[model samples]
Target: SLEVPFPSSREAVIALRSLSPDREPRKGGISKQLTVSGSTLSWSADEARILRVSVNSFLDHLSLVLETMEMFGSPVSQ
Candidate 1:
């Protein structure tokens, strides 16, 4: 399990939703899970080469989400 902390719970939830859609392309032999509690995103996966690739891809998407959040402010408009 890996826990990634966000500045706010809202951001954590946003990240969770953004990252949740892309399920692993293959079935069986590999698994990935993502969830958010408070201001932290929790991730777990099966240990394998695919895990590294999946995590690297997730990190890439995560960075983009965080950067967009930084630039545009909160996702919710007042």
Candidate 2:
């Protein structure tokens, strides 16, 4: 399991949505799960290799998200 903290719950939820697949994995015995609680994201995978790949991909995407957030501004509602 991996736990990542975000600045806010909204940011964490955004990260979770961005990282999650549109549909569940088709392969059997290979599962990846992501959940957001408060300002943190928890990730779990059924295999080591899958976990590694997912983490690397998530980090890459997360960096882009953070950079975008920094470039623009927080997605706060009025």
Candidate 3:
């Protein structure tokens, strides 16, 4: 488990995964909705770090793209 991130929701995901590798675990998804400030916020966290890692990766990619655009120019659309 140490091969992954520290004590986090992701660790829980991995724990569940390890317990049921052949099939999906029946645990409820993490997160809840709140209505406040005349608005609604639906925040959630997965037991797996997959979503967090993906978000990080997305930010990294965006940063790289911005840096590249600053250094070079906009990429040509395909």
Candidate 4:
């Protein structure tokens, strides 16, 4: 399994809620059951601790980011 750490977290892929049938993306799980080991991500979430973030868990983070952006304004650079 591959493990990559996101220092800036700028490359995080956020998912859109509304989508057409043909444009709809597949959920992150098929590979989990098929492969012996899945990819792991290490992001600064909990006290900047490097933890085991599965594909599914990482996707959830993306989805949450998309949803929050839809509601709140974008983050400004300081």
Per-candidate TM-scores read 0.80, 0.77, 0.28, 0.30
Number of clashes found in candidate 3: 2
What stretches of model 1 exceed 4 Å from their correct place?
48-50
- lDDT for each of the candidates? 0.81, 0.78, 0.35, 0.36
User: Candidate 3 lDDT, tens digit per residue, 1-78?
Assistant: 012222334333433333233332335752321111222222224334544544554446435534554577433444
lDDT of 4 by residue, 1-78 (tens): 333432233322222222112232336522221111123232322322222434455556555655675687544555
Question: Model 2 over residues 1-78: C-alpha lDDT tens digits?
Answer: 888889899988887887676525656754877899999998877677777866776777778977887888888774
Instruction: Give the candidates in order of TM-score, highest first.
Output: 1, 2, 4, 3
Give the candidate number with the greatest lDDT.
1
Task: Give per-model CA RMSD.
Answer: 2.3, 2.3, 14.7, 13.2
Instruction: Pick out the ten consecutive residues of candidate 3 with the lowest summed lDDT.
Output: 33-42
Candidate no. 4 TM-score: 0.30
What's the best-to-worst order under lDDT? Answer: 1, 2, 4, 3
* Clashing pairs in model 3, backbone N/Cα/C closer than 3 A: 10-49, 13-47
